[model samples]
Target: MTAPARTSGPVEASPGRLFRHRDFRLLWTGHTVSAVGSNMTAVALPLVAVAVLDATTFQVAVLTAAAWLPWLFAGLPVGAWVDRVRRRPVMIAADLVAAALFASVPAAALLGLLTVGHLLVVALGAGLARVFFETADQVYLPTLLRPEQVPEANARLHATQTASYLVGPGLAGLIAQLVGAVTAVALDALTFLLSALCLRRISAVEARPHRGAGTTSLRREVAAGLRFVVRDPYLRVLTVFGAASNIGLTGYQAVLVVFLVRSAELPAGLVGLLIGLASLGGVVGAALAARLARRLGTARTLLFAGALTGPPALLIPLAGAGARTAWLVLGGMLVSLGVAIGNVVKGSFRQTYTPHRLLGRVTVSMHLLNYGTIPLAALLAGALGAAWGPHGAIRAMTAWLALTPLILLAGPLRRRRDLPTAPS
Candidate 1:
């Protein structure tokens, strides 16, 4: 399943080259639009909590927590379920479900009925939907392209997502400024619908899962995914690293709007614009990942990328009035850049290394560790923000980031030049 010879190149060149494949085009388009919408809410939802509901710092943190809390409860089971089903329909259904949930926000807002409770419910429902879509997506992408195309495909996808991070927030701010945050959230609903439509158009017929009649109990199936990860040194280490990294990353981000707006007293538009500009680093890192991997070797590149992700946080907590705001931008950009490269490498590795039938479960199992800490971190950040102030909370979270990369060095990665393409 190597890519065609002519198609081999760095992923930064992928956007122009990969378009020749029809299914990849659909997958790309669907994810691109969807990413823009998702990032819009990344800015809009918090603004709604801040401006529309006038929510407390703790309450805003709860909104962030609710969105991710589902993973802790449902992630393992959902991975097993997805592995037994056709991934595309599952994704489509998740999209439709998410659309309806997000759409409820604007509808409620327009009717003069919006509340923090409503926003929390929407976040919970949307988070559940995300569990399904993301699990299916990791398995689905490979079916549409050769193994070699995966890195490039991932790069293209990550680049677009980063671009959306670039554009979506600014647009959200403009919309939030002109109309309201509720209205900008409605745009997220629309993006889900469009994503569903595009996914339906992808013509590839996916192979059905082999877990047919008389298969093991769902619990065992779930455990199998967990077992595989726990037994594999690489997966075991990566999972732990992901959990630790997320605690820091999500903690800072959960209350970032509050920090930038209430503490620093930046306007909503400026807040959105600043985040958008800083996220440009992700786009840059995604483009550079392939060449960097080639140059530094995968294993070492990961170490370097891992290093970049953390130390920059010291800059973020130092952000201050006027020109000093540059600290947030510089720190955030480096974090984004480091994270982007690390993700491209990690994503491609997971997809290529795992067995096809186990892909969904394995992907989700890993994400369970990666995303599982998010809710707790959000709550912790909120509490810290409420008690110690946003600056104190951010400094603590960023400091944690500076330390998490040491987890990678503890793994076998330090001894290798590159991560092996297939498990031994």
Candidate 2:
């Protein structure tokens, strides 16, 4: 059966009017709380490995690797499950599960029982919940907002995420410095509970159930998502560019903490501050993205945004050992700005082009490519840095990033103009 058709019209401008849509408001609130909470883990988790456990560089790489491994292994299967289930329930369940897993860390730490093994288990569990929540979110979004309101809705989501990055790390740092890293993580768990509550308030039609004689095999469903992604011109191009960028960015992240500590001679707490400050650029970039696309045309905007991101990889490694820490921070902020713009442009384009029926499959397929290799790149960066030094490894990665523009040049993306204003 065909899904119910939706009417297209301009979204209302007033925030009050937007909030009156109860389901949208609830989703927004849930996402906001979850974003802040997730950022806390982003800051606290690595610190736990480095400061508390006194883990080696290779051990830290393992911690990062564990968190990302599930995406490579389970993303496609999770997407299939999301498509066959009600997204709201999946999102709520994911939040509750994540909260429970995150809370375990503090409990163990307080009991003097925290170990690298425990950390790895928690990270893997949290990553599994993340996969479910992310897959459900992509499919749930269109149901919450009308087509005309997608850009606005996306902008609000991005803004909240940016705000979370702006505040979450700095707050985590302060909490970790004063109380402890494990305690800081506990706060994130509380936020997840709140997110779960918010998600429960959303009311929408459930996804249609599968109609086959029986449930399809996981391997078959996974292959179907892959085939669709590989065959679609737009998705294929996006996956290529996204994968290249992620590989470079992951390499940068792998060595970034060590570089800041050794070459830049900065403290860990101060490093968090620098990262928080840099995130302000993301907020600015997200706010301006739609306007820039409207003025420049989507294809040109994407190319310009891609070029903007590539040059900044060179800046991070060039700062050298000096009191010029402020310059390093500034350069990093510029890089963040470029990435934020590219994300908004790419996100808008993807949502506009993808068919609603295949949205869940396509989104998960894209994410699998975007994040699957993060661990591999992280491991490579750590090993290379150990052998050749962090500075040299970073330089190599920066040089690799220069090739990212070639993805845009080679695809139909090169010939495309502005995205279609009306639905396909």
Candidate 3:
């Protein structure tokens, strides 16, 4: 798309800065809706399996694994494809397809045909769509705004995403308690339809890149993207840290619902409210991330985020009856806040440092590593839960999270104040 005019350096942000950018506002609103829908399923889908199908803890976690597995299967090739094609259309198609997939859950329920298998298939289909959408969305942001505005844009987007976490799950829980978890998927589907509709209205012109006079192949293009990420020290280290962190992060997430419902004896609606409240940390973090980066320097802010991300997780495992649930909320809030800050800083850095031509590839290459571990982590959590018990599994996984910050420290991020504007 014809990007907004360039700003020579970082620009001062004022109130209502985003409202002034029409295309950005449209894009932001679309994704904000989509994110809320996704978060709703994040709570409702598992509830369907656990409450309706009486699925095992392992099976519930398997749903999570199914959702993230596509990152391993399609991430690299999809990234390459996104680089060659127009990103906006890819995003639009992904939203439409995901909407249809989620819609099937309620339909099957009405037909008395809902099963764990159907949910797994829907999760996988939606996840495959997510791989393409996220890669393209990452690159698409830069196309909408100038380099100077990227941080602000990233922060704003993250704020809504975090806000979705705060709002979506509570809504999902209430819906699940009132209607049915299956019906929640229907709402999720409707949100995606709106997302697709909004996306279609953005009037920006996406620039298409001409590729390989006649020699291009998916395998070769995937390799090219992989090489770029691996060859760069900063990118390579970031990928490693992201991969390591997700292992622990996803592990706990896989079993969190079970822990709350069974161990803590919380109702579905309360579970949603508690997790949603814990997610409020991201709202605060997103609101402050850019200012923190500006004040503490980007590199230090990242390290600071890492420090906040890991240690408090131990409280989750300690969560018990009554007031003890506060431990889980506090621990989770810290983790969410840290992740939000890190994401805002890292997202802006990646978009600015990477060339426009390579943005899609580079973004996905990193995500390939970041998200690739999610399935494994989910499976591990399930197995651990089965073996030890849900609380024990959470304890084990969060302990790993406590150590992930060490990986970031091992890199050169500690040597500088701000991450460099361009790749070294």
In model 3, the runs with Cα more than 4 Å from the true position are 1-11, 210-215
Candidate order by lDDT, decreasing, is 3, 1, 2
TM-score of each: 0.95, 0.91, 0.96
- lDDT by residue for model 1 over 1-424, one digit each (tens)? 6542121123344556688988888888989989999889988999999998888888888899999998999998899888888889999999999999999998998899999999999999999999999998998898888877888899888888888988999888888888888888999999999999999998889987774612889888788889989988887888888899999988988888898889989888888888888788899998888889877777788888889898887788888769988988899899989989988888887887788778878988998988999999999999999999888888899999899999999998898777876666
Question: Model 1, residue 380: displacement in angstroms?
Answer: 0.5
For residues 280-314, what per-residue lDDT tens digits would candidate 3 score against the true structure? 89999998999898888888898999998889777
TM-score computed on alpha carbons, candidate 1 = 0.95
lDDT of each: 0.87, 0.75, 0.88
TM-score of candidate 2 relative to the true fold = 0.91
Q: Residue pairs in steric clash, candidate 2? A: none
Native-referenced Cα lDDT, model 3: 0.88
